[model samples]
Target: MREITTVGVIGLGTMGAGIVEVFAKAGLSVVGVDGTPELAERGRGFLEASTGRAVAKGRLSEEDQAAVLGRVTWSHRLTDLAGADLVVEAVPERMEIKRDIFTTLDGIVREDAILASNTSSLSLTEIAAATAQPQRVIGMHFFNPAPVLALVEVITTLLTDDEVTGAVRELAVRLGKKPVVVGDRAGFVANALLITYLARAIRMYETGHVSREDIDAAGKVGIGLPMGPLTLADLIGLDVVKEVCDVLYAATHEPSAAPPALLQQLVTVGRLGRKTGQGFYAYEKPGSGVVTDAPEAVGRPGAASSVAVVGTGDLATDLVDRLTAAGTTVTAVDDPGADTASLAGTPVVVLVGGPEGSCEDCGSGDCLIAEGVDPSDATACECCHGTAPEAWFGAVAESLDSRTVLVPTDEPSAWALLGRIDPEVQVVPVAVHRPTRSGSLVEVARQIDGDDGAVRSVDATFAAAGFVTLVTRDRAGLVVDALLYPHLNDAVRMLDSGYAGAADIDTAMTAGCGYPQGPFAMIDEIGADEVADGLTDMQTETGDPALSPSPLLVEHAVANRSFLG
Candidate 1:
């Protein structure tokens, strides 16, 4: 309960040393212990080097570095932590190893001192049971690069006392990290959802559905992730990923977390990632883990002179922006009033929204239109939208005699469109490599131009990931608004079902799911009507009573008149 002036960090590995550095910089004296004095000294050296790097980067002053390094006292003996007010065990994630350390700490540290684990995959309850005071044991999972990555998961087990949980949350905030308290679930929240997603991605690759680069491209470009899961796995070390997967699978009994065959093989071969020389793709840069390929490009001389982007949704807007960015002339039009002037002197490509239907130029594969350069080879409804537009696009592309490239935004849509497209039509989904601040294709194009890179290659990456298509697909729900609405409605449903209070549900999801905002707050941010429309779409698609739009959602959507409202 007292202010933690002295802290003990057991085990001084990569994560351990980082933890020590974080605490020391926070002005807390640290007793960092390792198995041997040599290991302990190495830990101290890592701390010094990390702090020195900060000083070199102007993040920390020279004096501040010295002060921070001076705060940590490396020790080989467990008994050295006797004077500490708090102890965080960052030992290798093994039950016996952690149990052994906790057993030792129970005898050495003061009875009142709180004990925590930096174990990401291990059970907090089991670890706490090793100590006499199980109430003090909690999971304080700091992300990799402890001092830099902002989110800290504070896991509270059934046995973890509320006061201990509060203290850990306070400590995390004190260390300048965003803290979210969670229940002692397997992989907690982020890892549980993320690892499963990663496994599926790997499976998708292994099945030869998409290339490794394309998989990474889909995640980085399609979803706004800092790093693709493959790259992240490489950075974290493939061995560690495999181990984490094993632990999650063992704890949760879920097959999704079980490491896929390709993942295991890559780890086994030691092509771990940037750390190794190879992974999903050969890393041209050792420390940075950037990927490159020089395969012969395919599908040249396609007939796509000018395009008409139909629909006024976000997808259509993104398409207009992207097509313009790609140096292709584009015109946006509603069904009733088609602007023929915009299609002047260019072959028109119709981009339809929602499911495929009777196009204005149906049955006529080639609608001849007189222009400056002979009659144009007309392609009716170049693309379509919906949950699985890619299948439709794929089907359409396969049959086209003239070469044309059809782009789909996300996996479902792309796959749907892909099904309908001709096999010969070179399909390029958006797959961005670099980090993007904005999800919009227009912004990404600007970012590509602003940064020093081959514009053609960057454009290709966008095309590969389907960013060129501009329609973002929802994996769980049908559309963005629809996909998110049920979750928010579920939060409200939780309130109605007496599962938890509104604030508590929000708190849990924020801490538990890494949602930027809670469900109710999200409804306001995303607009109630938008959510309602999405739900209505989902309800129509699935015919599930549960998916029917909530009354509150209907009220809010109509009242606000916008999804964001």
Candidate 2:
């Protein structure tokens, strides 16, 4: 492995400047190069501002910050980088520009010097092809605000020398980064899965399936993400997101990788997210973090006229409290006296118990049976009797006159099954994983018979119950789980394939993307077997190979061992 002492960073943009700061702060001599002296000076200014903020936050002493800044030499000439042991190109996404710089550096730098690109989506092979020493070229991708973020994806092409990749990976670790090595592929690992998930969110917004706030809230509360996908895209800049999506789509030809038309339209109009003060949601000003609802944004749901709460459990109790707070006329019937007739006049009925137990007829003639419970089984009446699909369908069928029947459960399959029971029945499956205060609800639409009004109304009713309603089509995994399971499966596969260790991958996601938990920790909390089963079911339903459960996940699940263990 080659020793890395001095580093050269090309292009002095936001990413480039950050990369310069990272290397300098790591106690390395850094040369910041740009196309023009003005750009080089601007890059210096960014570094100064960034370090100044650190000083203000008491993270770095003024003397230490000065020492870090003093180590970086800014210049416009490419020849200044000739003495560097490694040159990381952080130029724009344009291929011509990146290749041109590589071609120049190929002649200027020493033959043994490693060349790397900090591209999020571009092909490493194509970029390496520009130089005569393709074997010496690899990818050293650093997340945005490189000094603050700890992830560094060390990507290697087929032609890239193993030693060069290893050297870069080791150097990244030495620079206080968590490095993960992957093949030279579009979007690498993080963006490959991330772009697909973002595109799905964008599609949901474009089709008016849900509001922006709900979409973001689902990510935050449902999966414990630090920010919603749309919000993150805005902070990242919509144009940049679109560019990465385009690159991934072109490379894989996957529908999920393609940017939605709405995103393009927003970009075309110069509404490039927080950078331009407008995207999915409007920001207070350009580059501002304070977000206000868009002008035509749909307001939160108002109080419902009447809603009936049936069954018992924590979910029921939470629902009752939220409904009452929303000023809805809550008709709670926890006793055996309350029956089908008790819920007859209520437009919305929230059933909390599983299939089995029967309640006295609320005057509707038939017993009020919980869905998915077996009424024939004498033990089914127990409060803990699991939810039975047949019982739920039967209950909903008896209450056919009710405007909406809300089934609160975390099982996506239950939602899919209930939605299939009767296409005409307004069966809205709700997944409330987080507490009511988190304001996250996964609302699955089992069937949309062109009646957008009815669907929106049901969504509003639930929203009024203090749940942030994330609407999605009737599918096995719905939105959050559908996207999340597959991504985690991929992470497991990466671990299994030795692309990266479990700890490194976890550190990369948590540090790089601000995720509350890495994939392994998530699987542990949700149960590895449960996650594997969810992914298997989704794959079986959608026939998407991407959703196929990983063998590693299956083995760990069967053995009951943690991924870390």
Candidate 3:
């Protein structure tokens, strides 16, 4: 609750020095500590070089840089933190080391002084429990390159006081970083979700479902992430990522947090990251630019071709848009009525319909067909027979007979279609259910083709404006739909459990965690039937109870009476 003018930063490795530089640049006098004088001086020098780079880049004035640099005093003694109001521990992640540091600090700092940890992994509660003043302990998790990445996770232990929590939140904002408050669970919000997602990505890569390059490409292009997960792992230092995963897995007992074997082996081989000149990608010696081939010496698979989408709808449309923008191709489909087509002939199809309609039911102009009624808008179909899709799939199969069919529908339709399709046919189900952003479908197709003309192009439609694509082949949910469904369910669970509200959860995700939109809002944007279809597909695929459609979602879909509307 006290105003912070003087702060202490414990440990001055890369993150620590960055933290120190960040605080001092904000005009706070910082006491930066290390285990020894040599280490303390080294940490100071690291901060100087970083600020010097800023000065050279004209990002900071010389006078301001010097003043900022002047504010940090290096120390080898723990007691040097005695006069500071806030102490942020950026120590190595070993629990013994952190426990020792906190126990020592408990005797040195004032009772009202806030003791915070920059631990991205490890339990905030456990760290706090090590000290006599557990109420004063909290988490101020700064992202890597702490001076640059703008998000901070403000974590609280069960024993942490409300005033301390509020103070840390205010401090984060004052530092020009967006902060989201979370309980002291392992990995907090960002890492918990992010690491698990990244782990899944690795598993996907290992399983050969997608290549490393395409996996990264998928997150960057498919999920709207700034960088691919593998590239991020390299930059963060694979060893560090492993350590974080180990801590998280140990604490949460969540199997999802367990580090992949490939990640650990890379670290053990001394291929840490940019620091070691190699990782998922090799780096330029003495610099951070990545080299893609070093890991092939250890059996890394070469990249996969970025997925090439063939049509324009909610799914293929965006595929055309993203692929073209990414410089791939967008093939146009001339006629859905044309028979004798193979998936090799079409490769993919975007089946556009409302919830009540089937591919057979939808009108010739890409509209929904419900019973005997033909509707132009396919966005709001609410009919759910659980057997209608089978009837429709059979109709579609009979219509296209003997030729391979690639059906990209929402989860329910996909599941129904999957059951009806003959196993011998070549059917590839893709999940691409996110909306289109500002750009041309012509451009998105170019990106998908990626300069491989020999890669064969067939019928492709590039619908412009207000036409978005959802691309998932034969699953309960396609890529975007499946990704969003679990999170929406999690959001409902979070609100129902009193962890956060709709607005706060939305704010936390959009502002604090970098999601494009909050879960509930996205569901509304996507439509209830579409979401239900996705969940239905997922549950069918995994037979997992967790993937089942929520009663709330079903209610909304029924009341709306249309997914396309």
Candidate 4:
């Protein structure tokens, strides 16, 4: 393949200008084009503002910034790109406009010159087929603010030549970007997984299974995302999100890719997210990230001076540590045989049960009896059947009064335990999820009877302990696990279909979409067997095929292997 020294970038919008800056920063001669002179000048302003910020931040010297700008030759004409070896069009996402540009550029650039598009959605194959030298056309999809983000999805159509893709891939490396080669698939790597996940989060909220606040909190605190999916949708513009979802759904016919009615309605109402100042959330104004209506709008939590924790393992141990560290007097019980007499006087009683945090065999901790198992044939896994959770819960409940708030940690059916106790002791659903860099989160399930004293006390207690708290409804998976596991399954399905390699998918999510960890890394960190089991259990509950574990995930989980390996 010929060397790519001079490059051409068409379209001078935010994305287009960023692409121009990327090439110019790499010391390549660039012909940055636009449809008109005004847009071209505005494009220059984009370059100036970006580099100016870098200089202001001391990350770039004024001389270097000037040199980077000096390498670009601005133009409004297609003829100027004739001398360029690679010309990437960052025009609007309209198919007709892109096809016209390619058809025009087909005669302008040389036969061997690579013609690439920076489309986030739209078919690269159709665009390539519009040109005379189809083999030389490819997709060079760069994430927004292209100069900053490290990922560049290098997409290849069946018509694209191997040399063309290779040259583009090498060029991406030289440009200081990580390129993940993929077939002509909608949303490609980063977006395919990302949009699907976002859509699911929206659906979850729309279904009222979880509130919007809880959904976002679940992603942020529960899964350690930088921002929640709804927050991201607002920033990305709901219109764009809907548009991409439409394309993905059309391409794959997957239900998860279908845009939720809430998302579509928001777009129709002109609440196109932060751009309009109203999407899933109301922003301070147009084009602002500051939310006007914050989720944690509630007043200070009701205080709990002393709490009693019952049961054993990591769940109870962690709770005890956090509560003690917060200065709340915690009466601890490590052994199963420990007395429950102390649980009677405390303001709250936190029940952290057996080997699985609750009952071992029972699903969702909803009942002492595992679903589908006969009462007579219950498993001997002491937690569910024998002298385990049933014993501790009965003991603790027998001692506690109506005044004491009981929180069954990670249990969905904490309310059901009301029968086990004599008094109407408010049972709150509390799930202490795994801790992240941000800190641990205690998920509180909203009580159906409007009993919030338990919620506030649990919130206050966990908050004082320096841990975040999110209140979701009493549903399966609470908020985090329900939304997260399915998205990982989607990534696995992508890998299973050979659309992209494991490393590339991970790279795309981590580098392109600003994820803390890739899906595969999450599966490994969360445990493959754990994720697969979560998906399987969720599938049985919701009957969503998308939530069902992929055969690959099951294979890996059964073998105790990581997807990265």
Candidate 1, which ten residues in sequence have the lowest lDDT sum? 442-451
Q: How would the candidate models be sorted by lDDT, starting from the highest?
A: 4, 2, 3, 1
Each model's lDDT: 0.62, 0.76, 0.63, 0.83
lDDT tens digits, residue span 135-249, model 2: 9999999999798888899999999998998899899889888888889878877777677778777876776756777677777777778788899889888999999999988
Q: Name the runs in model 3 displaced over 4 angstroms.
A: 267-271, 294-492, 502-524, 527-532, 544-565
Q: Give the total clashing residue pairs for model 4.
A: 0
Q: Against the correct fold, how does model 1 do in TM-score?
A: 0.68
CA shift at 41, candidate 2, in angstroms?
Answer: 0.8
Give candidate 2 regions above 4 Å deviation: 159-163, 265-270, 292-349, 354-428, 435-439, 442-466, 470-478, 489-504, 527-565
TM-score of each: 0.68, 0.78, 0.72, 0.91
| Overall local distance difference test of candidate 3 | 0.63
Ten contiguous residues minimizing lDDT sum, candidate 2: 356-365
For this target, which candidate reaches the highest lDDT against the unseen true structure? 4
Q: Provide the clash count, candidate 1.
A: 47
Task: Give one digit per residue, the lDDT tens place, for model 3 in 1-565.
Answer: 6698899999999999999988998888999999999999999899989999999999999999889988999999989999999999998888898988999998999988999999987888888999998999999988767888777788898899999999889888888887888887766666655666666566556655445665565555555556667877777777878887887788767555689988878888998877788877766773566574733422212111233232224544444454456443345442333332343433334443333334333322123223443322222324532324334444444434333334443444443343345554434333332433322211121123222221112112222222222221233343434445665655554555555556655665565445676666766776677677667867888887766776766877779653223
Runs of candidate 4 with Cα error greater than 4 angstroms are: 295-297, 354-394, 411-420, 447-450
Backbone collisions counted per model: 47, 16, 64, 0
| Candidate 4 lDDT over residue span 63-119, tens digit each | 999999999988889999999999999987789999999999978888778899998
